[model samples]
Target: MTNPRADRVRDVAKLAQRSARTRRGLFLAEGPQAVREALRLDARLADDGAPRLVAEVYASAACLERYPELDALARATGALRTATDDVLAAMADTVSPQGILAVCRQLDVTLAEVLSRGPRLVAVLCRVQDPGNAGTILRAADSAGADAVVFTEGSVDPYNPKTVRSTAGSLFHVPFVIGADPAELAQQLRGAGVGVLAADGYGPVDLDALQDESAARRLTVGPPVVGPLGDGTLGDRALGGGANGEAAPEGRSSGEGEAAPSYALEAPTAWLFGNEAQGLSDAELALADARVAVPLYGEAESLNVGTAATVCLYASARAQRRGQRTG
Candidate 1:
């Protein structure tokens, strides 16, 4: 019934590309748990029963021997493709193909979805190209209890195979959103009452200065947003942007509000982090209502983007939890 590219990596990639993987722009997850996540998203969740999964059913004996369980899981999950192992192998992406793979649809989310969620915190990533960094940032967003992870125009794709692997399981739990135009995201955040903040490698105010006291937050930055992109929204300040998009204050922003105010976590807030090496540009810095920086000790220069993002997100979470208990 199939072209039967069994035991072939190229064919596997191709078949998968043309099948659900392409229609939904998703990739194959090799591990059992990974497939389970896909099933969960599709409403095939079973807390204790044998988890249904997706896989090529008519595999060669060798392929079946390699991943016998995948067949059962596929049948359970209703993702079975009755094709020879050769065909299945043709459509996969692994070097030494794992007999099991689950198809996932890439999330096509927008900024407006983030606004409607009623979030209290958000994280924004800007031009963080490293897939590892992108994945770590997503994990941090979940750990920090962010409502959403937002990406800017030039950030790395969260669905990039390496990136998906890097996220571990956090990839499935987060509500991510992607936006092509920074200006459009800005308008959405404003309407949602999310105040955007920029992270500076050497800004005047401390990172702890971003705790807020109002509506839910929204964040934006990077290319494809990841994590909880629910009530909050996130975005990046144009790298090298100036105060009001001018100069001088480009490294940071000085405006009407108190430059370094810290509030409860329940206070709505969105925080933006910049590129890996170059940091946020002047124009980008100008876009934020305020600029935040990690309180450095030695002469280390600066923290890695992932490290900085984690710290900021965790801080917001901590404050928010504290507020919840107190309130």
Candidate 2:
């Protein structure tokens, strides 16, 4: 494996392209961290009698000595191969592959499979174009304990080299569904008892206010009851009503007669984060039960999608955990 011009090197290098990756159903995971995670997942799946994820591993001798755990995990896959630094670089997407790389099978699951698992928190990326942003959001979702991450049809491919690198190995730790339709996905999430929320800069609902209400409910005298909108009297206030318990702000109310949709921060929720430039489309926002905006006290115009998502997901995670404890 010392020759960088070998056919095997070229084959592995081709995975950097989306077309090649799709054709082979394989992608390259470069660097010690990414490859180690891939091999670890492969080992876990294998232990569970599931299909293995790592198809092959190419590592330099120095890498194996530097990270003995990677060497052990790679050998456990029964697909480890020794290669020179030149060969490793030739087969990797990164300028410096960090002495190791692995070829892994795409691990995306179906939308039905994800819903069937009864996920409590999910992140939906709607037409997010940047690979780095998508990866960062996925990493945030993983850190926030989200059940899964969903990428809509127009979103950037999660298997892209830049995205895989941007994830920093979090890609292997989370379950994700690809190519979901926004409208249909929303309906499905609702059907599964999951509330759909859109992250919009101009949204009427204040995220902080929702958190405060959630905390108050949890600490109240009575046990918290969870159900659909209009099931209880918390609708108006939870949506966007003022502190005095009057009607919500103009254009923010549900209607004159009907109660506003209930969006308890503790309930099962799937958040929709839109593109870096355009944000969520009007149609996409309409798919959500409510649109929530991350408040800014400072002079910043808006928060990045990744940062906003971290805030929203962590909010849900905290509320959900508190609900579990208090219920």
Candidate 3:
């Protein structure tokens, strides 16, 4: 157990600041959800081994009694530590501490490694400054079954305590990279046969139009039509695996008058979203193969980054899983 004034406790408290976190190579997971996820994923933020993820846990006695699962995780990881309520409060970034907190290494990966998987769906956040919006987008990406999310340079740090909390534990579920170059990322994804679409308010391609085109194409070809090669030519390998003319999965059809199946969303796609206030810059959006505008029915203003991303990513998920039906 440690008192609020102890040196070690104070060191942990210092991580609340970005500068301290950068120097120490650690961040705080302030609540049960984030802590449990850190333990479950056991991702290695640094090259070191044996320490594992979730190096230490601090909880008040009342917290331990209330959330026995968290307590068990601490015990199982050999990371259990005791702190008085006041000590825990001093370490927390939130007003209402969840009574549990963990010291975790930052979670991130190289962009090359992220793209090596040949991801089917991805979201790229460009210059998005809000931590809450960033975290919510991550949660939406996870929900949409996106293979990964990329946080470009000038975007919020994924490990920011508020962002981590906003994810509600989804930060551990999906692979993400921070501080990546937007143009380079687009080049890499295109090289991997992934189509990059920029989500802009005045883009050329319409989301619903893409859906309609997808539904119509699915009727002719067996599966959703992934784009041709980077050179804008229809190579045999255009549709990813379906490029080899692999037959669509059994019992799938785009019947006439039926709702436009979300087949376009199925194609290997990555959506680039800009910041809330400024949106994507002209130069930044120019890197994409195409620009997609989310159709707004109501007269209300534009969609926020998080909501727009959720709609875009899930549209792809639904399109991709259209005939597969596995969930």
Candidate 4:
């Protein structure tokens, strides 16, 4: 533990690479926050008769003293190793590991496993290549109390060191499924009674209007108010208008003698967030039941994927929880 160049230090450092992590079925959780969360999850899983998540933990004496809880949790895993600052740095992915790091088993669950949970809200990342954006979205999903976050096949590796660091310990807090095929995943989610929505800037449905409609439903007593579209439902008004309240372009109007697709905001839902640059592809967008756009009131051209995702997920969270309370 004292030697910075020891084989054990090098082995843990190898987790910084995707190939090594894949081969060993482990990833590095750097910094005190990440390490602490990992240890806590390990303990929880152990209580369920599950295998330990933390294969090993390396910490400097100062770090253990600074965070006694971390020391206790790490020791509970029976994998804690006291190491010099130099050795701890050698084993970490960050420039500074915040005095501690843990080698945790890959925590991704199968798509079937996630679906079995009857999740009310889920976030799906499609071809998102940025580590920071992916991690931030996962963190946002966790904050919104999303049931799970799914990473499409082409999305960035959720286990990447930068991505793990960006989560700020949220990686341990949220359930995630990786390498899912967008089309198949969409089908499965819908089959599970979950509505799949794509977050597109040019989407026909305005997210704000959906929130308003949800709020209105919650405030109503007997029957819902009949909008001008005359379906006795707000779906047409909410879906047939653009973010600016303008009528949807030709062929996209839900008010034209057709049943407006009923996408109740309070329903079980999964949101698909696309890549930072190109956004959702046509095929990917097609997998969703509806495309939703987050409104931008200011001069800002667009919202970052993370910010947009936060808005969308929290929207669903609020609507779902409120619906539950009322029901």
Query: Which candidate has the top score in lDDT?
Result: 2
Say which prediction, candidate 2 or candidate 3, comes out ahead on TM-score. 2
Q: Write the per-residue lDDT of candidate 2 for residues 106-152, one digit (tens) a residue.
A: 99999999999999999999988888889999999999999999999
Mind giving the per-residue lDDT tens digits that candidate 4 earns over 1-327?
899988888888898899999998989888888888898889988999988899988888999999999989999988888999888878877776689888889999998999999988999999899999999999999999999999999999999999999999999998999999999998899888888888876665667777887888888786532211223343434333233212233334433453334367888899999887778887987887766766665555567888888989999999888988887
Ranking of all candidate structures by their TM-score, best first? 2, 4, 3, 1
Error of 4 at 61 (Å): 0.6
- Candidate 1 per-residue C-alpha lDDT over 119-197 given as tens digits, one digit per residue, 9 for 90 to 100: 6787777777888888898988977778888878788877666666667657777788864455566556756766666
Query: What is the per-residue lDDT of model 3 for residues 1-327, given as tens digits with 9 covering 90 to 100?
Result: 657888888888888889999888899998888888887766443334544777889988888898887777778777788888888988889998888899987767788887888898988999988999999999999999999999999999888899999999999889999898998898889898898887765553456666665455556645446763233121121111011111112122212222222224557988888877777786786787755566565543456778878888887787777735422
Candidate 1: worst 10 consecutive residues by lDDT?
A: 238-247
Candidate 1: segments with Cα more than 4 A from true spot? 1-24, 44-73, 81-99, 208-266
What is each predicted model's overall lDDT from 0 to 1? 0.58, 0.83, 0.74, 0.81
Winning model by TM-score:
2
Can you tell me which runs of candidate 4 are displaced by over 4 Å? 221-262
Task: Give the clash count for each candidate.
Answer: 58, 0, 1, 0
Lowest lDDT sum, 10 consecutive residues, model 2, at 238-247
Q: Please give the lDDT score at residue 16 for candidate 3.
A: 84
